[model samples]
Target: MGSDSKQVSKIPKIDLSGLHPSVAGGERWEAAKAEVAAALFSHGCFEAYFPSSSDELREAMFGSALPEMFALPLETKRRLKSDDVYHGYIGQIPHMAYESIAFDDPVSPTAVEEFTKLMWPEGNSSFCKTVEAFAKALHELVEIVQMMIVESLGVEKHYDSLVSSTTYAVRLSEYGVPLNQDTKIALDPHKDPNLVTVVCQSKIDGLEVQTFDGDWVNVDPSPNSLTVMVGQAFQAWSNMRVRAPYHRVRVLGKEKRFSAIFFSRPSHNSMVKSPEELGDEDHPLLFKPFSYTEFVKFLYSEEGRKAKNPFNAYFRIGNEEAA
Candidate 1:
């Protein structure tokens, strides 16, 4: 998805180990918040070091749930379907050796339970528990980052209203080594359509993100860290003040790779609009308020997927319109 021919830099790694809202006015918390804001706006992503997320969670996730779930038969995985676009099992692509399955609203008991039942007809309670707990941890981290971004933009008052209508989807992706020798692009470079995305990568490092200067970055996430990305929805919400990065997975080693990505989005029916504080004389509004659901439908369309600047085509306001 990216060219390593250009200089490869490490994506910004921030230690948000003990962040809390109570310290919002403190220098330490504000410093961390500013770093996060800078990384999101320029690099479009940051590797977060959150100690509260324990090693056991990562072990259980990568050790059992991911391997076991991906081992299931193709037919079994196919049974995990969804009415929503791109929310279900995705596999059988022409070139990519990748397959993924997701549970919408992973934090919801009913949602995870339903997905578990489908994946394991007899009911795999362990998977359900692990998914729920892990998702919750990631959700908390997402909230911290969101709050920081809101505060940085001086729209902290809008935080509660914004998150009140948020929904989440978590997906586990598996990429196997290819038969050929050369490195292969396991996943295409694309920006997610949601507001925020937090990725839990395996010990193996292969994900690459593009920087504002066009350098490709190799992200190596420690057990304590997860890669957090600002998505296209955030671009509209922040009036293009924050960029949604372009990232892709590349596979070279023989070992299989697995990653769990959690997406925080506005509820499907809700509108995504920039806050009043975000639009000003210098930073004009770049998008009209858009429907979270309809925009997803557009990205899944043939035209949307093919465009290099999908948001520019689908939601971005032109210069004249902005003026």
Candidate 2:
């Protein structure tokens, strides 16, 4: 789909350096909260710059491990393929020229080792170690971002229990740019199924977000900046006050693109619902509470794939309440 115009709107940028424990209650922290709140309200996506130490870990994953893995032969990559979406390599699909590897529990050493062995067969300890280290670092950063979102909404105290059971996964994606300008779509438009997604992209930019006015704007990749997108769970939790933007990738030319995306969701048993404090008569709970497991099942189902908003099944607005 073509944009209404060639002009692209820049996503908001928020510095997260002040999130350190040493300055949790300081001025910088409040400023960060305000910036984050505005971004979440308007775009549902924003750029976040963390400390240098965190950037090093991000670089190791996107700069080192990802390229090394994607450079491997297709035959070797196929060895890690699985029917399941939560783990292993997924081959390219129509309208997209990228192959991706998913690590269900990125922070788990055993899981990483098993995944690495599946790819290398013989051995690749360094790959496993690097990914595990990167995953752990990113996980910690995701938690910090989650807390910031909670604080921005003024529901940190109410949402404290939910944070403890959050689940995470990391995916390494490489998109091949098409030679033909006619081949426009790299990825179809859709909202992420998780609570939030933090994406670190390689220098090339193809990621685009659909604005409220129905225009697609490119989200240019920046050095040491991770892009964050609010998702369906966040929208539900906020009683639809927050939104999940629909985004897609458009390959410009023959250049290749890569990204390491970390998705954080509530645990399987955690209920996805609007916080009571955020709902009132004017805006009653818009979505019915759903368990994370149920949502996942629907997310991957045939019907879910066809629906514009797969999470609409959980909507309390016009639909009968769940028994």
The number of the candidate with the highest lDDT is: 1
For 1-323, candidate 1 gives per-residue lDDT tens digits of: 44664244567889997776545667778899999998887778999998766889888899899999999999999998788888789988877788999768888889899889998989998988999988888888888898998988889889988999898899999998754346566787788888899999888877888876666777876878889999888878988778888888777687999998898999968998888888889976666778988898888899987866667778654442211
Which stretches of candidate 2 lie above 4 Å from their native place? Answer: 1-6, 21-23, 53-59, 73-87, 313-323
Evaluate model 1: give its TM-score.
0.93
TM-score each candidate.
0.93, 0.86
Per-residue lDDT value at 59 in model 2: 68
True-structure RMSD, every candidate: 2.6, 3.6
Clash pairs detected, candidate 1: none
TM-score for candidate 2, please give it: 0.86
Q: RMSD of candidate 1 to the true fold?
A: 2.6
Off by over 4 Å in 1: 5-8, 21-25, 179-183, 316-323
Q: Model 1, residue 318: displacement in angstroms?
A: 5.0
Q: Write the per-residue lDDT of candidate 2 for residues 18-82, one digit (tens) a residue.
A: 46633456687778878888888888888888653365665676677888899999888877654
